[model samples]
Target: MIEGGALVKNGHIQQQLNQQVPDASDWLALSLLPRLGAGRLKQWHHERRAWPQQWLEALSVPQRHYFLYLRHPQGHGQVLQPMLDWCTAESSRALLHPDHPAWPALLNELPDPPLVLWAWGNLACLEQPAIAIVGSRHPSSAGRHHAQAFARALAEAGSCIVSGMALGIDAQAHEGALSAEGATIAVVGSGLDHTYPRQHRSLQQRILNAGGLLLSEHPPATEARPAFFPRRNRIITGLSRGVLVVEAALRSGSLISARLALEQNRDVFALPGALEASLSAGCHALIRQGATLVTTPTDIIEELGGPWRASSIQGAENRPACREGGERQRAGHDPQAQRWLVLLRDGAVSLDELVLRSGCSVSDTLNALLALELAGQVVMCGNGWTLSAPSSESGAQTR
Candidate 1:
């Protein structure tokens, strides 16, 4: 029985070895070196493309030490053997260096692309036309609704929605795309081994089951960290043809994604929001700085000029209009809040400007903006605030 079992195991190993594509295990192993980042490794990979031995010889002592450490730890060939064995065992699930046919073409366009992307699920999704929807973790009701509606429309038109799978806007965007039975990609900061927010576990499973993708540059078992997210944002923008900012404060991470998208030459579309709301300020700022202003998904589709089926306009029509009225009239019910909204009405003004203009203390003005934003009386645009579109009754009242 032992002999028979050994024969079966040996055959399986032989089959795997035969089927294995040229393992860039050597290249990937190089990435594990603490000193080498994507830029440096790319340079090394190109030089090694010809005269491979000479490439290894070109490294400095420190570089050489790191390389040798990965290759044969502590001079134990047996230690190195296990790593290669593990690579071989996991070869089917692994993606190698850039030369592989499965590597995304989009990554090549970036100034710094990952040396190797550890991917799972349908690799073909990488080739699809995609758009990124990103925004605050804590979004207003309007912001959440807008993200979902926009994502649904874009997905129905055959565009894939890409996002960070975060809470608030990111979560709603994914749900919207899925609800429309369209493809979406979640570029997570955490590893595939565990979902970051924990609440989104079911959503993650749904994304996988629905022919969508869940991608991470980080290897499995990696933990979430603040630093990883900023790095991950680049990938989100890198994967998309454009990025849409739903709602974000001035320092929101979504703005970081927007900035990266611009640097990558991806189109940036920001939804216009009231100038007075802190939450909308980041997006408004981007628009003022020349990011395309998008009020509907069609605005985006028209800009892209892609072949997309137009869904019903009902969704667009249902969106809440911006609140209207001078800061004083609107603030009548909330006197302190009215003071802050009045300060924001003169166009996009900074928080500091609001403090100066409102005559209220800094803490008091901030509290007022928060209350006004939740009341849908104001929305943030970029680094400033603005009045929301008023309801018909409110408009009449103003008149």
Candidate 2:
């Protein structure tokens, strides 16, 4: 058992430390050393049997000369200590290194996977099929809605929703899945013990409570640094079977994840958005450059094929009913709600026709329709509100 300030058990920090297999502490210590990185570490790990000490010894001559010329007094050995301490401290927090048996095999396939992963919640969830949903951190209302709704639908179909767990789109994506009482996985850039953006603490707890997993590559006490995010993005794509870009600016990190996905041979899907919107430029570029264009969960399922079939799309279409009546019943009911349900049963009806058929005043019908939408019972496609597949009525009643 490893005991340190980092070891958290049932919310209590443990004080005793024990030697563990693979000594992730040692790996973390090496990784944190100045001038040492995944590339260099791999070089050493792959080239020599007596690598660790041998590599350190080889750098001594050049390292000392460079330090003296630069008038910096830090020695190579001295710089390595803090990283070692970091590893030891992190071990107490349930953070595991790549050497751990619990580490997901998918991560190893990346060209430069994190040497260590800081995981919170159940580790087993990593084995399940996962789809990564990424988009603008400041997504528009529609973008946020789509992100969450898509994630929820995918989650309901027995796939885990994976995202970077940022604000806006990322938060909604996780919420969407949780709203459906489904599993989600949040891959963060900060340490497991630290939740960035502070506002998401409550959301983070909800995720854990709902059996979702939160993961990070940074050690405890590590703040949100600029460079840590791109590395984090890689893990987001690496862990999933495919990556979905919902809404992003041309230079957004979401696009980087898509690139990484392609490099890693994972499918990339982009949601087409308004051509005039700058926020959607990245997605459009991806689509134009060969990424699959996804308009619904069905599009995603069809692209992935196999278990992710058109039936999965039908399943997603049916989810609205389960969601409307689930433990977290939708917010409110209105005349439009009943009308929308009826129209959905009748299949895609024009707005004008819907008003005529539902028999409600046009103004009242529109208002009710909007209310039903907030409840997730209806979705607007083209010029009409298509009844979301999973109607709330019982099967016999629907028939």
Candidate 3:
């Protein structure tokens, strides 16, 4: 079985993906229609539940002809079949339609929510309390460090960090989260099939290995273009409780995401950089425009709180991601401690991850971890806890 977003090898796992969902194909077809862009689609969303019918009914003659063309073999093979195959290509891959339980409901608050989302890796990250860290593709060295530090801090505090998976600040933010063994999500402009920047292929795989997610709106194999990047920022902001600008020039796209966050009524946080630095311009602008100026991860968490806390917005609490856990453990340490030991068998694990993987509440996990530390069974190593010596649970022996 796929343990951590491993791509299907033989291209199997085709039986239950997207085939059973109601109106799934219709939604995918709508997303793929060449002439029907998100702007036009949003215009007909006044009816919400009935918008699909409205979209079908209001299609112009050419649009209707195009839809008909999609039904034929030639158009189906060229435009639709690849996506169909990609969705069923692996158990880790999924086409997240609105009806799919994995679909992020926060996107619905947008004026234009995607009809179908291309999701890879852990779907649970979509529902977790997320904070978006965005900024310039070219940032100062200090800017890069801040991005990584803030992301790592927030992640260790149990928030899923979101970013565009771009160079500079975005890449550092994702890396920081993975280093903490914390959850993260990358919302990219191109299709899931293509990794933009080419060099980020390893970073992408690391994210999935850490139980993170990679998301895209485009169909598989679709190449990136100049226009796709700006549009993808909306999804990045939409997925988070707030947007943090590490470093940005006034005219940069980071400002665009901050503007979108403001428009969506989501919080915007900015870090103050050197006054003479051009990279600090957009953030200064944001602060002047009333975005929160944050210096620590707590500021972001206290301001936005963690996932379980009450949110100013709805839906954050309405639907929690339900995970299927392993069989109950018996003997040795308490059930919570046992789960922790099994997970840390390979190596160290962060407190946030211990809470997440062990299915224990924050207090319980911390208290048990402390007991282990006191008993010399485990020790704090860097940002995570590791076994101090061989143990019955770990099955490791000292020479």
TM-score of every model? 0.68, 0.71, 0.70
Per-residue lDDT tens digits for candidate 3, residues 100-193, read 7877878878877777889999998987789999998988656765687678667766789999999999998997788567899999999998
For TM-score, the strongest prediction is 2
Regions of model 2 farther than 4 Å from truth: 1-22, 43-93, 306-309, 321-337, 341-399
Q: Is candidate 1 or candidate 2 better by TM-score?
A: 2
Weakest 10 consecutive residues of candidate 3 by summed lDDT = 313-322
lDDT of 2 by residue, 38-107 (tens): 7655555556435233444544454423422222123324543443455456333345666677778787
RMSD (CA, angstroms), candidate 2: 9.5
Candidates sorted by TM-score, descending order? 2, 3, 1
Q: How many backbone clashes does candidate 3 have?
A: 0
Candidate 2 achieves a global lDDT of: 0.68
Greater-TM-score candidate between 1 and 3: 3
TM-score of 2: 0.71
| Model 1 spans with C-alpha error above 4 angstroms | 1-22, 43-48, 72-93, 307-399
Each prediction's Cα lDDT score?
Answer: 0.69, 0.68, 0.73
Error of 3 at 33 (Å): 1.8
Q: After superposition, how far is residue 273 of candidate 2 from its true place, in Å?
A: 1.5
